[model samples]
Target: MRLLLLISRLDCLDELDALICNAFRRRGWEVIFGEINAIAADDYRCFTRGLLLPGSGEPCHPGPAALGNRETYFLDECQLVWVMSPPQDYAARDIWQMLWLASKRTAFVNSIEGMMFLDTKHALGYVLPKENRVFAYTSNDFSFLWERYRQASDQWWVAKPANAGCGQNVFLLPPNGPNVRTTLQCLTGNAVVQSLLYNGEVGAFKPEYTILQKFILEVANGEKRVVVVCGEAVAWYGREGNPDDHRSNIAQGGTPKSVELHSGEVKLAESIGLKLMEHGINFVGIDMAYPYIVELNIGYPNGLYNEMLTSGVDRSDRVAELIIASFENHCSLLR
Candidate 1:
């Protein structure tokens, strides 16, 4: 069997991508690397025609005419396509639409429709519980923000971009702070404002804003990152933030350590896995602080290398086996 690894760029290969590639190769499946923009509708037409050469370390660059021709095919030989990049442009969206339509014949690890549901922080309000919900609104007016703040008794608010992740452009809005209007106007424009989930217990403050979320104070100790594959929590690890830093993301200088989850936390992770499966998401990294989920990562979940290094246990082989089994099951259903 063959698998297509769709990524944004061939130049930058992260640890997860490398691990995934190695896993599939070890399983004796041919892995093809290609950019999403190179895919077209015609590529889904035939089973005999291959889009690009199999197991070619070089990137695939099928021409537009070749993509338009029904005789020309790419990815037609592959049984599964693993999307590694999130849609960031119109071209990417177009490719996603083609992939969605093609999913009828080809298996995708996580469908485009599922990714869209978890792409933005605003989407969290729908899936997460009421207490875990972080009210998100896109507007620059201070009056609107003030009205929303008045509705909540919380003393702090956070402003960030609705579409970003990894704690980018996140800021704290304090109650009764001087120059509130200026800060809100500058930060909340074309952004999202959420009630702060954390208190002054953490430490001093930093200013950044592109996406906003309720800062959970429990993350000061560290946050749990649970890797769920095919609706199972296969492995998990803790990410402890730097001193006084509220962001525990590994990208933000957070340290990784092996962790054991309690029954409640395991149940929570299972619940999230079920919800993700409903949307056809089979692999994900869920971030949580005990009772509350901080984020649901759908696009290329991280922490495999760190988890393996810290725990002396690598689940990549298991993940690879599951992916292959899923494909086999899919083929069996067709038969």
Candidate 2:
């Protein structure tokens, strides 16, 4: 059977792509790699029916030479699709919608609907403990958050865009900070403002609408990244921000290091894994600061590659096996 990996392009993630491709190839599966634009344009239908083997250094066949007059190779022949890129703009969103509709008939690593829902940084509050939630959407909501912070005797707060990742545009707001009003004015659409969490404080807040949460200071050392695949917490590591910054995201100059999760931390990650499976998010990377979740990464998480390089623990084999098993189960159900 054929498995499709839908990506934006193959230039940037060469190492990661090679690992995944090799894993599936060793399992005797034909792997197809295609760009989102090409797939959205239905270009695969014009190609001959054949497996796109890994390390071949060739594009997908463009003419029907091996199998004649087959028009449904992508939709009918493929059993599973792993969407490995984020939809960053309107065109990408359209392509994602098309893939979402197609997923009704095929298995997907993480459903488009689930990705859209969980991709927002604020969605973690729904599954995490109440003390770890925070949300906001408007100026009025900021006022409500401020009032709650005041009532709780909090010293500082943090603001972040609800739909962003990699610690972009996140701000720390002290109670006496002069730019609170300006920051609130600059924010539009969905945002989250929460009391700074430190020293065992509950650190929760509320918006006039939606939910709000506390920002964990456990990040002072760094945050742990737990990679979960098909309801199992397989591999994990640590990420520390630059000395001058408080954010522990690798994109923001955070450094990755080997880490071991405590017993309680492992239990928490497994529990979150179970919940993510229920949402059809089988492959993801969860960032946490023991006892609190910082973010849930659904689109193209990359710690595994670095982890393998540094630690020599290649979890990609297990990830590929789980993906194959999930696809087999899904196909069997259809039959």
Candidate 3:
């Protein structure tokens, strides 16, 4: 079988992508790489520059359309296309829509429709009970934010972009904080702040709005990432934030360690994983802090390398097996 991994860029494949690509190749699957921005689509054909595996030393097969080290590929040729990049531009969105409409021919690991359902912070409302989930307010209006902030359960709130992940643009809002307005302004991009306060740095992705969630004190201990594949909890790890930082994302210098899920967490992860699988979202990483399900990572969930390093076992092998099995099962059902 053939698989196309849709990533943000070819030259910048991270550890997780490299691991997955190599794992699938070892399983006798022909693996090729495609960047979202380089894809050109039409009713007749879908074209892209198939990138060579980085650090492969030199190009072996130089096709007619080979530009430098890249090869030409047609989207219809691949049996499966695993999207690892979120659609962030017009070109990417166009490619996504084309592929989505042609999903019958090419199986998607997580369909764009599935990502739309549970990939963002907004998904918390659908997955979690009102009392169990974090109390969040999403809006671009300053008045709405002010009202929500005032009604928060605690004096502190976690302010972040609604669409971003990996702890990007996350901040702690102190009660009646001086930087409240400035932080909201920066996050929502509604009103420009003369100067950023409280270590507020501009993010890479521009967000349409922001989510102000009531801070959970229990997060001081740590957070958990439960990796679910094909509606089953396969592996999990714990992450603790760096000193003086509230963000527990490994991208933000947090530390990961091996851990087991509590009964409640196991039940929650299993139930949610099944529901997500039914919705065509097979691979996922569910983040949680005790009673609350923080985020659902359906687009590109990290931690495969970390799982191997911490547990001394390659879970990506299991991930690959499950993905192929699921894809074959889906194809069989269609047949």
Candidate 4:
């Protein structure tokens, strides 16, 4: 079967290709990398790339035409549209209409609506219940922060913008910093200062650039989990941080290692997968650090392809099988 993976082209995605594309090839199915651009669409009309994918309807093929603004467009050849990652423009624009359409048209690993939910670390406690989940301690305003810190001079707190992940614009306060309001404005439109989380070390708590969350000490498999409901564990890898640093996200210069999941971890991964399905998010890449779910890469998860090569396991083939199975299941119910 031919599948289309739409995403920005970047070197970080080497692992993804190794895991997915190589896997598909091994299964005797064709895998195609598709990047959709509106202007490029007009130039390549009615043209099919040399990728073979089969679905319930007919052999579906997709190309740049899948993206053009002919107002209404449909592809009979494309059985699935895998949005590995939306275009760079989409994030800056906040909302992407085509991505929404693709979700409706075909099986989206992680639907557009799903990205709207899990991309930000703010309001994480809301998505993650306080009962099973831990929240980064936070105060709504600067005055509350100053008063709280002064009461406990020995305590150190770190503040993060409402919505940021992957270590973006994180600030560490030195017990006291002037211009609380200005700091809030600069860091986040609305921000919070929260008590730092650590095992025993004391230097500065950046909270690893997401939420000021209550940290969990999970026994990780070295590689973080990226569970894809429509397929197998297509990829697994994470950055490794030394004592000086806590986060191991590859984007932060951590070394990559293959992750192996135990059966319980697999079940935990599946439960979260179903939760995402409840939110109309079927396919996702889960980041399980150690104890619980740390981050969810829903938009377009990269790195699996490369990891596949490293592990000699092709998750893409499994993903293709899962997609076919789901499609068949849907069609069967209709029949």
Give the candidate number with the greatest lDDT: 3
Top TM-score: which candidate number?
A: 3
| Lowest-sum lDDT 10-residue window in model 1 | 61-70
Which parts of model 1 are misplaced by more than 4 Å? 41-73, 131-142, 150-154, 190-214
Measured by TM-score, how close is model 4 to the native structure?
Answer: 0.65
TM-score of each: 0.79, 0.79, 0.86, 0.65
Q: Write the per-residue lDDT of candidate 2 for residues 154-232, one digit (tens) a residue.
A: 5556766666677877877676667765565344322343434433344444332322344556766678889888878
Worst window of 10 by summed lDDT in candidate 2: 61-70
User: For residue 98, what is the lDDT in candidate 4?
Assistant: 45
Q: Which sequence of candidate numbers ranks them by lDDT, best first?
A: 3, 1, 2, 4
**C-alpha positional error of residue 180 in candidate 2 after TM-score superposition, expressed in Å:** 2.4
**Model 3 stretches with alpha carbons more than 4 Å out:** 51-69, 152-154, 192-207
The lDDT of each candidate is 0.67, 0.66, 0.77, 0.50
Q: Model 2, stretches more than 4 Å misplaced?
A: 41-51, 54-73, 131-154, 189-213
Cα lDDT for residue 250, candidate 4: 58
Q: What RMSD does model 1 have?
A: 8.9
Tell me the lDDT of model 4 at 114. 63
Q: Tell me which residue pairs clash in candidate 2.
A: 133-212, 133-213, 134-211, 134-212, 134-213, 135-211, 135-212
Worst 10 residues of 3 by lDDT: 58-67
Displacement of the residue 146 alpha carbon in candidate 3, Å = 0.7
